[model samples]
Target chain A: MDAASAAIVAKPASVDGLLDLASRDMAGVDALIRDRMQSEVPVIPALAEHLIGGSAKRLRPLLTIAAARLAGAKDDACLRLAASVEFIHTATLLHDDVVDSSELRRGKVAAHLIWGAPASVLVGDFLFARSFELMVEAGSMQALEILARASRVIAEGEVMQLTRSHDLNLPQDLYLEIIGAKTAELFAAAAEAGAVSAGATPEQQKNLRRFGKNLGLAFQLVDDALDYSGEAGTLGKNAGDDFREGKATLPLLLAIARTGPSEKAFWDRAVARREQEEGDFEKARRLIAETGAETATLELAARYADDAKAALAAFSSSNSWRPAMEELADFAVQRKM
Target chain B: MDAASAAIVAKPASVDGLLDLASRDMAGVDALIRDRMQSEVPVIPALAEHLIGGSAKRLRPLLTIAAARLAGAKDDACLRLAASVEFIHTATLLHDDVVDSSELRRGKVAAHLIWGAPASVLVGDFLFARSFELMVEAGSMQALEILARASRVIAEGEVMQLTRSHDLNLPQDLYLEIIGAKTAELFAAAAEAGAVSAGATPEQQKNLRRFGKNLGLAFQLVDDALDYSGEAGTLGKNAGDDFREGKATLPLLLAIARTGPSEKAFWDRAVARREQEEGDFEKARRLIAETGAETATLELAARYADDAKAALAAFSSSNSWRPAMEELADFAVQRKM
Candidate 1:
């Protein structure tokens, strides 16, 4: 097998071993998600059927279900909470495509490209409203509070990221802060809601939430790294797309910080002007490699993965949730796409 | 004085009477609305300073406060609820300009034109999220549920309108339904929430809400009529802008329904196509007048105003809110801009 295929095969074996431990417990949650994702609006149902019924990793919902199971109170409430997280995640994706002006998502023409921007935006609003309605039905004030705050943070992070575009001076701390608000907060909320639904002890819920947050951070860092290194076809997008858009992701940010003034000028002209040609992309890759930015970024992602695994140590080692939680940590750093 | 000036002078005398009735009771509610509209974000503060701090009529908030007072409540909660309603209304305007690609509003460059679409959309989301946060702080689940559902319906109505663009055959029932969801529901919610917040009896709240709903219907129909008849400079927009956009407002819908075969082809080529030259505009206007569509629309709007006034019979004449409620019903039918 080719190196990429070999790597993919190795990772799933680890995931399989983890899933075997808790497969039965997750079945009902999965079914609930499939049911609630359906919509009554004709266009909505068609769009959703194509998008949600396709191959989604369902990572966020999995975290919620696992967290609930670990809390030791399996019930229908957990299923509803899990569905809420997935809906919010889906809603954000719909809006994000509009913000990014993306033409394709998940190998399909984006909804905005097909239906029009106004329709896509309103549909995204519909999903957001629907998600809130579902959360309210969950009937926990604390859950409502958590989800609302997370949604606001996500929006704020997006605005901050927009303002920071092409600014090579962005610090690693700022990068972490942005990702924490935009991505990790939702992940953390998903786990917390699951624990809350299942009546987990406060301390246990906090620990599980921390685990999800760290895992999410690591997941995003790895995603940014892969933008520079992954194959375009496999990623289902052009390689270096972030660089083309002048988004200063981890590898680019670190490289700018470490590189000399002369190399920095090249990046400033290319990315800040959003004028990267064929040769400029190669130079960016080489500069990132020469400055050890790629390696440093990967190391940071690995550290986060390790931290995530350690956070789960508060639970019993023999618990069924233990293995799935570990695979999540591993997946954070090792996934190809 | 000329006949029109005499009528204008006479109208303000009635307005003065309404203001005298509600002035003392409304001071605290007005002050609360002014305070909570402030924002900490630089863009938010700048935009709000220009938009909300301007001389807005504050009609919606006044209806909310007046409805609460009519229900015999004098609590701070009503003020906060009124502020929340206004915030949601303003947020929609910010986003709507971007959706419509409008260059001007209220005789100035629109917020999106001034700040860019991305900023407009994000700021709009911030305001929306902040409004929900405010409602949550109000600590009323019932209020949150009502406002949340209203928001969803408004968004759905927007999408429905987008889909129906330039369709001259749009049914009058569908047109009213769309406006009711998009415009009237919020008015009803504003009134209902005021009463709900102040612990009004259920029957009183229901009557006041119905009053607001009917009043809102009249208000929108008059606004649509003014699009064809109002002065361009005074209205802060071009006359016949709705006709140019092929919006099936009540008048246009009525005109299309009544058009004979001879003029139907003209509407199909000009109005339905939304491609109007100077001659086409004049011809279309003449045709609509000849069909008596304009008069029919005015009659329908007046009927709603009558229904709105009838709803106030439940409250005693001595109630402090009675005069302002009556003026609001009259204003709904008579406003020129």
Candidate 2:
């Protein structure tokens, strides 16, 4: 067995420990979220609740709470920042679903589908503004700056992906950059903001941010792999959605590279022109399995999970959050959904 | 003649003084907007420039600059705030165009029409985030708070209008509330943020906010009136847009009330059902003019303009910006477009 494989087997894959530890903090964040999402405009709250209430884990805000408590935060400032982080995440998801014409989110009908795209867009704006208001109340300009910059970077990443997602020739580094900006940047910011709110040392802030960034990469890589490996019932979102959308995720890209000349015509027809027939997704999945692309993708995810765990070296092992967060990193890669 | 009519005739309706007085400062604002709008992603800048570069008046940002200067601001902080105000306005316009499926904005094709709705939505998100980044750089939490609240209020107003705008029986008070939240709140926030940035006294801030609120009401009333009374060639946007969309603007509602039983069937078919034939817009305009609805709307706008001017009485008459701002109020009601 490879060192990476051995490490993956040795690590426990569970978020239950962190969830237990941060239960009170997460509840406070949840309360703040519900309170702030309300508006006199009936559609705003209805539409926001449709998506927000469906989220099971809310891992991004969990990162904030866990990072804050890990850094020995004593005040409730991190609670607001945590809620603000979730709001920012929710706002982006609303915009993203509209941009992608996504049909389902968090195992339910997407907000845009239920309320119409216009309402979804406007409600997203409302949540985004509400997030800044929460940040302002938190009274941490440093956290505000981090989240604001993350917001801009996320938008930029979305635009870049919009222009580049369909191109089969897109480089691996650029793809990493895209996901780094769109997904991992927010995770990094969320943890950093929490640390900043807690008045953590600069080194602690940087390390927590590093942990979040790597964990987010692992989470997204697993997400991409699960689009092929996961079943629709367990995945919340439909499996093969990326394939149907012709999104150039790493699993498909690696499969294409590994299959090489034999699949050239197939990829050109299926992906480049976005024409598909019955059983095409099945065939792609089969090809990916034959090429070991799914395994390769999971391996990459596990490496990132390992890096995420390593980032906790600065924190004392005596602290329970340290080991639980390492388990969270493993869970990010191992979870099926 | 009544005192109101005499006052209307006595006032000089021109923005030329304000434009000239703030030309140098506005130039700085213009430069800041241009520099900030640029992005590594090409489409963002391209789409942003489409709407922003076409705005000849930029009334909101102009209000911010005028308010700061009138409050005796000697620093460049107001310039960043002014630029931020414009970004907020521009972001809303981009999203608004998508929500309304608008074809034209600021005298050119709407950005969404050229780039597609997804691009427009994402780019608007970009600009909105960029607005906050600019606010953070300005280093005034008070200004940030004011703008953040304005943004949330604006989104709520839009959602309310989306649900209520098409109703033929929408009351005038409700209509005023809709427009006040949708339009006036930002104007009020812009001026107040400027005042706050300049370290103005609480009274100065309150008066400037009042000035902006009244000016915004005057501006919107004239706009609603112009839909029936102005020409497309002069208006930039097509004339009768409100009537075409069956929007229950003040003039339309007033005309509906004044014409009463005589024109009941025509309104029911044209506005209530939104089922119009070729000549419906022209006929609605004719009814509005014949009923003196357009004139009543303008009279109300003139009153608001007067209130806007009165709000500036606390500022010294010696400051050139004071008279310039008052002229801007007059011009809001007086302009043909």
Clashing pairs in 2: none
Per-residue CA lDDT of model 2 for A1-337, tens digit only, reads 7534565578646789999999998889999999999998899989888888855578999999889988999998999999999999999999999998888788998888888999999999999999999999999999999999999999999998888888888888887888888899999999999899999999999999999999888888889999999988888888888888888988888999899999999988888788998989999999988899998888888888889888889899999999999889878877889
Q: For model 1, name the residue pairs that clash.
A: none
Native-to-model Cα distance after best TM-score fit, residue A97 in candidate 1, in Å: 1.5
The per-model DockQ list reads 0.48, 0.86
Docking class of 2: high
Model 2 residue B326 lDDT score: 82
Alpha-carbon RMSD, each predicted model: 4.1, 1.8
Quality of candidate 2 docking, DockQ = 0.86
In order, how many clashes per candidate?
0, 0
Off by over 4 Å in 1: A1-41, A236-238, B1-41, B279-290
For this target, which candidate reaches the highest DockQ against the unseen true structure?
2
Q: How well is each residue in B1-337 modelled by candidate 2, as lDDT tens digits?
A: 6434564589746777888888998999999999989999999899888888855578899899999989988898999999999898888989998998877777887888899999999999999999999999999999999999999999999899888888888999999998899899999999999999889999999999999999998899989999898987788777877777788899999999999999999999998888999999989999999999998998898888889899999889999899889878878887888
